[model samples]
Target chain A: MSTSAAERAVNYVILIVFAAFALAPIVTVLAAALSPQSGAESAGLAGLHPGNFVDAWSEGEFSRYLRTSVLVAVTVVSVAVIASILSGFAFGTMRFGGSRVLFYLFLLGIMVPAEAIVVPLFYDLREVGLTNTLWAVALPQIAQSIAFGTYWMRAYFRTSPPSLIEAATLDGASPRRVLWSILVPIGRPAVMTLTVLAFMWTWNEFLIPLVMSPNGDFRTAPLALAIFKGQHVQATALLAAAAVLVALPVVIVYLFAQRHFIRGMLEGAVRE
Target chain B: MRHQRRYLPYLYLTPALLLFGTFLLYPLVRSAQFSLFSWDGLGASEFVGFDNYVELFTDEVLRAAFGHALVLILFFSVLPLGLGLVIAAILNRGQVRGLGLFRTVVFLPQVLAMVVVAVAWRQIYAPNGTLNTALRAVGLDELTRTWLGDYTWTLPAVGMVGTWVQTGLVTVLLLAGMGRVPRDLFEAARLDGAGAVREFFAITLPSVRGEIAVALTLTIVAALKTFDLVYVTTGGGPGNSTTVPAYEVFQRAFREGAVGSAAAIAIALTAIIFVLNVIVNRIAEGREE
Candidate 1:
């Protein structure tokens, strides 16, 4: 099982090449964002400069979109985590008639692509006079996220020893207390992982917001960037700049929580 | 005591059940009902029975969109799965240093908004963009073409971007699956005089079959429902060449004001996805058995 020098060399070369191919587009976009000139003409990797970033930021209304995106993402994650915790604990610990059937029904939400229901969702929201509001976007996303979040936390909680819950009950701890004290604390890593995923998905979601809020004022960062590109079609530098701005937060979150993000997604994949 | 405990579980599940009924179940039923009616999403819905479904079946545009979606499955599902398995095999060899760095770099695309990925790739595929420049620099100018605009290449070309974005996800999943593969089995094979390639096929591939199936199912689902990538890149341009079911739904509902027809398309898509899911799950279950 000892490694050979030739094998090690080959591995390094393969890793380098694959890594470059993976990272190239991101690096290219970042470089383009920094380019000075803002036009349709070819920049050829030479026009890159810092000044384009400033222009992209100021001209694109990126700050407002970033704020809206943050608000939506945070709210969705917060609500989803709380709801998933309650539901996951409920499904995991409690035993009731038809619980298995109900849990399976919830799994349908995961299988049915969001795009399928978006039309009806739009009409429902509009009928309720909630269109163009942040809740319209946040509510559906939270609803969509709950299935996976519940499934995730249910797995985590099921694996957790039931003795702890029984002990908490024996100590006269209320059901709510048992969850907050016994479950939430122990499930912190899974909770954090879910939060990161929820945030990433909500922040990057495009179609729902784009269709729900066509007005310029309510646009999220991703939608705004899409619109910005269309409006400034001839401005490649600025478009790249705008794209970088939109992508930065998710990239930062990913870098810091890379392990959790990957693990959470992989866990979801295998379990389902 | 068992009965009391069982009731307690349902009590706990009440909130999820309520939400699922209201949001998930309700909308799905409502959509089915709506598909039988003609409405502009704002006006009175006139129920017309199965007319919408009949029209959708005959609609050339809808048929083409499904065709494009099938094409996208090749790009988004088949290619990514193949390339990602190779990458995962390479990384799983245990000789790669800076594994964390490589994984992050590969998964970077998954984190970015599809809007950003589409836009960035659009730039790269532009007439005189970086891809073309690189092609020319390497004396492949003759091979250079308007990748995103070309009718023949547009769907596959866009699907390639999807492949690029998702390959990292497949690789990461397969790597995790590969980790579960016992090193002893590999060693035993090696001792039997099996080469690396032989060992991989005999030991590694079988071990990760579940992961492969899972990855393929997820990628195929994503491919079939692909919209944002096409929306941002081509907007189903060059004469509806890249249009897919999702885009068709968007167009029919929003652009064409045919909510009933759009709902029918949505229903059809749901049916397709459901059948696919059942088939995959059955296959996975059969394999496990």
Candidate 2:
């Protein structure tokens, strides 16, 4: 495994090259966002102008959209995590009739793409007078996240120590008590991972918000950003600023929780 | 107490079941049912009986959309895998400094909403955008065009965006997999006078087969579920050159009012995703044995 100096230098060179490739577009957007607003041509790092974000923010009505996105992400993550815990606990620990079938059914949520269900789900939600509302967006995402969440939590719970559960049960604790008081506390990392993932997916979701909010009443940041792009086609800097604004929240969260996010997603790949 | 015990699991499962049934399972079935009819979202419809499914094969645009998805697999899955393997192998071998920083910068794309990605790239590919500007700067004015608007270039342009987003994911996955690979194996290979290429193929490649399969499944699925990018970037435009199955589903269902056709396309897409993942996993598993 020992590397010669020449080979080591080559490795660094290649890694740096790939890193630049990955970063070039983002840096371009960031530089443009900071540059003075102009027409269709990219300003290309002229003078600094921070007002573009303010302009794009108000003009695009991003505060409203971001608030809507936050609302949806929070609603989906909290509910999905709680529900997944219950179902994951049941499937991971207890044996029951149709558990195999039931687990497979949950797996379908992960396997089936959003495109497959979005159309009918749209009509169905509209039937119940739920379309165009934020819940219409949050509800299906909750269901989808729960599907992955249940699968994820089940894996975590399955490997949880049996002795601990037995110890709690022998002391006359109820199953629900055992979970809330014992397992959930010990499952903090798994829960954190799930929370971060659910939040990311919900925040980034485009199809659900687009389909659910035809009237534009409940557009999320990303959805609004898209609509803004069309209208502000001439304002390249303004568009870049809007893009940065939409991306800022996720980027901030990711910087703080990158380890958890990376570990969870990579582990997710391995488990599959 | 015994009764409570018997139903306890079901009770715990109720919330998940309700949401899953209402949103996912039922809609999936309803999509299938809707595919069998000629309903246009606002009408009492007559049964078409597989006419929509037949269109998936016969319709030029729809067929092309699926074909474009297949082409995207090269950029989105295969290219990234190739690049990721090389980058990962190099990083793993060298034990490079600042690995964390590199991973963060690279994986940033995967975290951003595809809408954000599409928007950023939209500027990058504009007529006087970053790409053309750079080309003109380099005195390659003839090479410059409206990349996303050119019929011949649009598909590749959008596909490169996918490549950009997915390469980080593939590299990180392979790096993690290779990290677990025993150093002794590499050392033994080196003792046997194996070159780096020989060592990578003999040791690194075989060991990370599972991770490679997982990477392929995820990226291919992302490629197939590409509505956000196409919608935001080209709007399937200049022509249907960049139209994809997911985008077409939206166009047919919402824009064109061809609900049945959209439903059929969605179902077809879901089946393709499922079958492809299964094949990838089976191949991975077969190789493992």
Candidate 3:
């Protein structure tokens, strides 16, 4: 049905207004980061000063934190994606005793809030002398991502054409070979979505790194930004710069692979 | 071969199961154990049974923290749901030009780290921040206050940040749901002498009931799980006005040395989140049938 011209006009107007509303705060921060540190909270265009990011980077030692974030994200994404593929393939294609029960247990990882477990997980890690190590942060997140990853990939695999698998099986291919050589190649989009998601979550994680790295050995970018905020309460420009630095990696990733990111988020909701 | 066939799936599942057992399931069991004892992290323990749970019900600060979370639901979940429904329905109906660009830009907030969001908003809500400056520039000097510091406004202020971050997500999700809606449904409604509003209410609303439920479940859980936003923006501050159960879990366990109390609160929060999600899902499922 054709929408009225007036209705379409109203739609565009509303869309523009809400889009501005969404971008306003971020723009405010960007403008502030560009302005001089002394005055002018958000200089619109003329008063550009780009040194705040450099200063904040060196002062807050954000390089170390960002590097740590990369390491943790790479660790979590690589392991979680591989593990999810294997387990998701099993859940999607194979039947075994207690499979139903095992799936539910995995579901618990997704359902239970991190706050519910971080306390004990911290102590458990500390007891094993793993606190303040990269493992403390990455391990739990790997497990959490695998939980959703397994669920996501299982859905993909369940709907995959059975004929291909049957053909491979008749040709004397093992399940491992089928999954590794055939399905994984065809399932690149699904796997890519999981990788992007796991990377985003790992990059943005705060509570785990905060609690786990008490000695400041493995603090990630977001945690460093928060701590920097506490110390530099008055330096709005520097803080904005740091916030931008911390958020830039994910924002950049989102920009390039937004299709995968949006698809993963919306599809996850729809499947539920 | 028969024996191997039965256990092959298990072999594939071993890595995932091992991770879950070590990190998730094991830790949960230990957290429950910690909740039953009154022990500092370094000292001997005493079994307090249900006392910590009792304290959660009685402590004014703790109760207020959970109460703040409930109030946050209004801004975070309910407000966003209402707003997203309107925006998404409009987008779907108009099939507006440059839909891709609009979706990409508007949905940007959902991808950023909460710390970044909190920081950006902190600048906006500072006493001399953008919000107050805008207020002053527009001749509303008397209306300004330190948003994150004011006891009366801090909770709502923090909650608005949640609203901003979550609205994009809800809008994007609902838009996807609305995309699946067949055009003939709207055409049929228009044929029956329905106005745009009538068409929306009669067809659009009911069609996306499942999406609405999914939106509510995700947003409500986000409201309850809010820690980073509150931690960075207000620190449950001025008083305990902005604290939530998640923040309390961290504060009690780490700062106050109330390990048992923190675990109890965490367990209670998890139960509330789980139960609420189940209700939302069940309602959606019920309506689907």
lDDT of each: 0.82, 0.90, 0.89
Against the true two-chain complex, what DockQ does each candidate achieve?
A: 0.61, 0.73, 0.74
Give one digit per residue, the lDDT tens place, for model 2 in A1-272. 57889988998898899999999999999988888775434444355778788889999998899999899988999999999999999999888999999998888678899999999988888998999997898988999999999999999999999899888787888998889999999999999999999999999999999999899888899999988988988888889999999999889999999998898887765434
Q: What TM-scores do the predictions have?
A: 0.95, 0.97, 0.97
Q: What tens-digit string does per-residue lDDT give for candidate 1 at B1-289?
A: 1224545666666666666666667777777888999998676779899998998668888888888888888878888888887778766775667987888888888888999998889888999888999999999989899998888988878988988888888888888889888888878887899987887798888888888888887888888888888889999988989899999889888888899998888888888888887777776677677
Error of 1 at B109 (Å): 1.0
Q: Please tell me what DockQ candidate 3 reaches.
A: 0.74
Give the per-residue lDDT of model 3 (tens digit) for A27-111.
9999888878876465534668788888899999998989999999999999999999999999988878998899877776788
CAPRI docking class of candidate 3? medium
Residue B231 error, candidate 2, Å = 0.3
Which candidate comes out best when scored by lDDT?
2
Fnat, one value per model: 0.60, 0.80, 0.80
Clashing pairs in 2: none
Chain B TM-score for each model? 0.92, 0.97, 0.96
User: Candidate 1: misplaced stretches above 4 Å?
Assistant: A39-48, B1-11
RMSD of 1: 2.6
In terms of lDDT, the poorest run of 10 residues in model 1 chain B is B1-10
